[model samples]
Target: MKAILKQHEEHKRELEQLNDHWENSARYLEYTKQELEERLYHAEESAILIKEELDEISIQKEIEIQRLKDEIKDLRQEISFLSSSQVNNHRVKELEDALNKAMREQMEFKEKLRIAKEQSEGGNGEVTEVTTTVRVIVKVRPFLDSDPAGPQCLMCNDTEVQIESKKVGSAKCFMFEKVIGPDDSIDELFMDLESNIVHAANGGNSCILAYGQTGSGKTYTMNGVISRSLNKLKQRFDCESVMISLQIIEIYNEQVKNLLTNDPLSRDWKDILNLSEIQLGNNWVSKAQDLIKKSCHKRQTKSTDSN
Candidate 1:
């Protein structure tokens, strides 16, 4: 009986020891498993965070690419605009060149035509020679007032000279001193010289002058005669085969002034008087001499035919 009880107690102690060891082993295993699960969970969380960061970076890269694309598009538009402008500028230059070429050709054609016409007529060419003559005409002042409504002459105190006469003719000399008076009628003065203007018109030159004091109706008479005569001549003698050259010069003080000077008040005596200094650049007068020659030749031919 004592042996059995001792055996039982030893067995009981062995069983308790085995139970405690088993329990400790199980607890250690559970702790190791929990640590591994915690590590795995933390790794999963880190991976998720990395994925989110990568997604954000990808989005930023896409946005940067889009912005660059927009910049490229704007640059392309600017380049296109500049190219179009360059083309237009080239086209305008071509047009201007064509126009200038056309004008030059036209002028050359006109000169050729004139030369041909002049060559056709020959022999009795004395009538073709351009003759220059100085002429004068005297007429009464139409307006009796000095300043429109004001009556009476300011300087002379005369009650306006009667319309004595008007003469149109060629003079053998340049200067004519007081050949007319205030009381001569136009018909009476023009008796012998009425037909003389016709001869002068055929290629001869004439000058009619009125010289006197400032308020002596010089301006009135000169302007009136010039206006009426020029209008008549332009209308009557402007045929293509006939050419008339008219020059109106004003002599102030001792200097001859050009009627067409750019500066009216330019007081330089040399500039006013020197016809050689006159700049007729690109004007119709550039071909004037040729035109005159052609007209004179035509006139000479016509006169010979008539005779």
Candidate 2:
């Protein structure tokens, strides 16, 4: 009976021990489950935060895209306005050109009538020959930056020029009233021509003509001559007693255009001149220079083979 009871006690203790072990395992599994739940909760919160950030970023991108679209629309409108303005400006320029042409034609007609009336008054159909001394001045232009490198072909002296001839193997000499070298100054040229040309104009009609190749400094020389001649005349004549009248005309493409009337920006030319007298002073000279500049600006130019 004691052995049976001891065996029963041993079985009971083993059952107690198993129960204790099972309880400990269950407690540990419960702790692990809690930890997993906490982790899952924190992950869900992070996902929500990230989704919110993405939504904010998307909104900002939309705003930026709309702003850019607005700017592009404004720029397109501005370009359209500028295009219309350019067209209007072109049409205005065409009208101004036409007005200038009409005025030039009217002036030319009046000049022709005046000339015809003078011829009628003279009444002598026979033309009178007036002997006037003719002087020819030759000027050699200096080498420019655009000029090609080559050997000198012409040697110039005070009153003559010698050109080298490769075919003849000789230098051909030509005599002129005055031969101006490339090194000569505009003042030197003006001085040479003044005594014969400018002074003679006071007594009778005198003409100074410039003819040359495209880039041979004809316009430059003529401008200098005009300025110097005006100053010399101002000094020679009494401003109070003698009045000087000036007229400038340009011929281009077989058409004669009055430069004084062509420039729209300049003041009325009649204000500078009167029927009975012309105002001559520093003010007049300044006005004249300004008018000349405006008129020259209106003169058309085209590129040539030599230039």
Candidate 3:
């Protein structure tokens, strides 16, 4: 039947989207790994330079200690030879004081080198990496064909987004990590986010929520992102051993309904008391889109506010 083929086509599209998302994620992770490696390399080089400077200072200290020891030894020999002829007590005392001062200076220099070495070798001679914070980004999708193309309220720059109010004659600006314009592709949107997705795929749980007012392109944007994430997971795991599950949930008027259910006519909230018990197993992909269509149809015609 035509319906069966259409359902099959939808599944294929879902799989394709998943594959693309995952591929993008893998690429992003590889790029991040390279960046970290580069940063570590530079840190190591800097550590080496610091060690070299400290070693130079240590070498200078050794040379000075040797010079001072040699001078003290010569002075001692001279004092000993003069002792038999009644050398001046004041001169002998001054020479002894100078020798003691040199020894003290040598010990102070060695102590400085010890402290310097301890600091330079904090992480097995590797400098600790700096931690980075998560950044929020905002993106605006392109206007649809039916929408008017003219000056809009939204404004975006590299680091912020501004929305102007015509009635209030004022603008509100929100700071973000990055801002994507309407002309940007979904790939551009996920360019920086793929690393996080890849991380999540490797047993790390991640939640991506698409939230906005009605008809704000939230579904469109999230669909693209979710598809990409699934694609990346495919690459990381074996196809034979891995199983992917999809469940679409619809909640209306404070009542929850599984959009991937068998009975498309199960829209009455009174029929189900506890929404928490609704569970669609891993095999819901077949009727997911069709059930969503039926749910939408019921919502538009029925008055959910009434009994």
Candidate 4:
């Protein structure tokens, strides 16, 4: 019995040790679980922080990319604008060159035509006498109040006129039979033409034609010439022996009309009457002057760009 009791006590002690060991093991397990849970929580927080940092970095990168794109777009636009400007400048240069070439060609052609005409005239089978049949006179008008203000491009002397070229940067000279400057008087011009044209009218058909741009004093000069010429004719010829006839006509818009006709509006052939001779007298001269004035009033006039 004693042995059996001792064995039983030993068994009971073994069971208590086992129970204590189990309790210690369970406590250790609980502590380990708590530590593991805390570590997992910390890891989760770190992951969230990393995600936020990544998002911020991505946003900054996107902003930088957008800024670069805008800069590139602006650069392209500037390049395009510069290219267009260059093209426009090149086109304008080409047009100017073409215009200059055309002007040069036209001048050359005109010179050739003049030479050809002279050659043809010389070759004609006739007694070719060097006579001043045609005379070209250049008249430079004085500046008027209505004219635009700028540097004078034309320079003139007694027999030569020079024009400064803007493109060539040189002066081009032209020779004429007479070059009437702004300072030259109407009397001088009349004196120049009187011996050649007015005196020749007595023997042959002679005409004094005034050709010029609008507002170049053509009418004023012609009126003065006519008055002077009539007085000169009266002085040269005896009134009884010489018979003077007057006919006045006007050409406007490519149509001819007799200014001295009974009907001013009539364009018929009958309206042009045959010129009759009358004794050259003061009465006839006064009538002629009056007729000229009437004809001048009937002339067609319009404003031009040059005027």
Candidate 5:
């Protein structure tokens, strides 16, 4: 009976141990599952935070883009408003209207001149007075020949044109129907420029100009002549006493630009003339003449105070 009681106690102890082992394993598995669930919850929360940050950045970028667009629109509107304003609009209209009127008047004057010429040449009822017309023929050879340069005009070919003056002064004006010379050579056009300088310096103003189509070499001719003339003057005279300051300007898009400087601003070309005339104590017949004179003398022709 003692042995049986001991065996039953041992069996009960083993069964309790098995039950405790199973309970411990199940508790451990439940703990692992809860830990996994907590980790998953934390990962989801992190993803939500990251998405919120990206959304905020995207919103800021969109706001910036909208602001920039508004700024650009405002700037365009302001430009349009300023462009439509008076200074540009009214002045252009006035100039156009004045030009049209001048053209009509010029046509009328030409018709009147034609009528006057016809009336004067036609025989009228008046005391007949005879004026003797002397026809003196003289022959002169041109410095340049026609074959080497160009053909002479048909009208002047039969006539023996005489040299009225060999010494052509700078200020003295002459009219040529057409000038023949090599395309970019100033020496041919103003052959007597150096010879005429002394005469010009004496009392008269020298004016050498060119008028032609844009590509026909107006600018080239004028530039060559002006540059050559100045160079000649500098070589002949003391630079300190007779220097030529050059001011190059351009009228572009109906506005004056100072080519010498970087400023694309319009200057009153009248101011230069006014100051020059004030210094010389002379009244200008016109503003343009004064400007021309001022430019010629602007390089300091003479010192204000001479020792």
Candidate 6:
């Protein structure tokens, strides 16, 4: 019985120690649980804050991406605009150069045309002279205040005329030896006719007769030519041996009269008409100027001139 009591006491003591160790383990487990719970709560709070930060970052990234896209789009538009402007500028420069080239070409053509025209006219004038023996010349009179103007019917160049023929339905251009306009000087006409008069005076039977409509300036031309030619003859000739003469006659209504009153006339009209006895030897050249003036004045007062 004593040995069993001692063994029971030893067992009881061992049980108490085991219970104390169990209690210490329980307390340690409870403290570990509380620390774990606290750590988990802190972890949860940290996760929430991190999630919020991540969400904000995502939103900012999206905003930044959108902003970058907009910037790219604007840059593209600017590039497109610059490209178009460059192309247009190139085209404008090309057009300006083309216009300048065309203008230069046109000027060159005009210069060539002018030169060709001058050469052609000179050639035509020479060729036309060889074509005809009977050369028709024309002179245009100036318009008088009292004269009435017709339609623009007359058309002529320097050496040619396109006049409607007298017969209807005919159109032909008449190439003339010379065409004188109203602007031509009277000295020009006298210069042309003087050669013939001088030829005749040097011993060729040349006669000049001018007849036209009444008051058509024929008398004026003849008078001017005669006066100018006489002056040339006086200057050319030494008057010692070259005796020039003149005879004048007038017939008024078929009544014969003498214009040179200083000389007597024979009764026979036949004698006066005959050129055989006529001599330019000693009659009117000595008293030329006074005789001309007298004769012209008398012709105006009386119907005396027959030739």
**Which of the numbered candidates is closest to the native, going by highest lDDT?**
4
Q: What TM-scores do the predictions have?
A: 0.28, 0.48, 0.45, 0.51, 0.30, 0.42
**Steric clash count of candidate 3:** 6
Please state the error at residue 31 of candidate 2 in Å.
99
- With a 3 Å backbone cut-off (N, CA, C), the pairs that clash in candidate 6 are none
How does model 1 score by TM-score? 0.28
Candidates' C-alpha lDDT: 0.45, 0.64, 0.62, 0.64, 0.45, 0.56
Per-candidate total of colliding backbone pairs: 9, 0, 6, 0, 0, 0
Question: CA shift at 115, candidate 4, in angstroms?
Answer: 35
**Which whole-number lDDT from 0 to 100 does residue 31 have in model 1?**
100
Global fold similarity of model 6 (TM-score)? 0.42
Q: List the residue pairs that clash in candidate 2.
A: none
Residue runs of model 4 more than 4 Å from their true location after superposition: 1-131, 149-151, 165-169, 265-282
lDDT of 4 by residue, 1-307 (tens): 9999999999999999999999999999999999999999999898667656655654554455344334433443454465667766665555555544543443344334334334444333222222577888776666665866432777776699888867768989999998866544565566457655543644765678999778878999899989887777666666556557777776666556677654444445453544322333445667777878887877778988876
Model 1: per-residue Cα lDDT over 1-307, one tens digit each: 9999999999999999999999999999999999999999999898667656655654554455344334433443454465667766665555555544543443344334333333334222122332334344434333332334321221111123222212423322222312333322233234223224445565454445566644556644544444444444445554454544433344445545454433343457575555523332233233444443333332211222212
Candidate 4 structure lDDT: 0.64
Clashing pairs in 4: none
Candidate 1 root-mean-square deviation in Å: 43.6
Error of 1 at 60 (Å): 99
Candidate 4: clashing residue pairs, number: 0
**Candidate 6 lDDT score relative to the true structure:** 0.56
Mark the regions of model 2 whose C-alpha exceeds 4 Å error after superposition: 1-132, 149-151, 165-170, 197-201, 263-283
> How much is 77 displaced in model 2, in angstroms?
60
